[model samples]
Target: MDFYVAFNKTLNRFDLKAIDLARKTDLSMQRVSQFKDGFNVRVDTLQKLLEVMPQEAKRYMLTLVAEGETDSPPSTGG
Candidate 1:
């Protein structure tokens, strides 16, 4: 699954909203909304978001990302 897809699932599972995440992470609500809409964010910003997430949610998201990486075909040298 894509990062945004995993994020959305986590939010749904935890009954969280963008505003809730913004308040918890001290990030702008717009940034959270953008992330939910599939925009990329800085690594530190992502870390802050994860820091505020429930442990289970964090694990779920990580698992999704790992699974997605594993599902991709290996790259070959040109």
Candidate 2:
């Protein structure tokens, strides 16, 4: 999943509304809305908000960042 899907999944699980996330993460409501809705999100804006995400969410994000270089999943079948 990309940033948009990731953000929405976390928000849904946390029962967080866009407005709540905007304030908590110090992001503009428009930015958060755009991301959650699958719009193009700026790297700087995303990075700043990511700084304040929950530990679990941030961990998930770290995994994504670390794996960004690999585009395909490993083959499983012999």
- Number of the top candidate by TM-score? 1
In model 1, which regions exceed 4 Å deviation? 69-78
- Where model 2 places Cα greater than 4 Å from the true spot, the runs are 61-77
> lDDT for every model?
0.83, 0.70
Candidate 1 per-residue lDDT over residues 22-76, each given as its tens digit = 9988899999899899999999989998998889889988887877643246456
Model 1: lDDT to the true structure: 0.83
Task: Give one digit per residue, the lDDT tens place, for model 2 in 1-78.
Answer: 577766676666556577876787778898888887889988887777777677787666555545542235644669
TM-score (C-alpha, index-matched) for candidate 1: 0.81
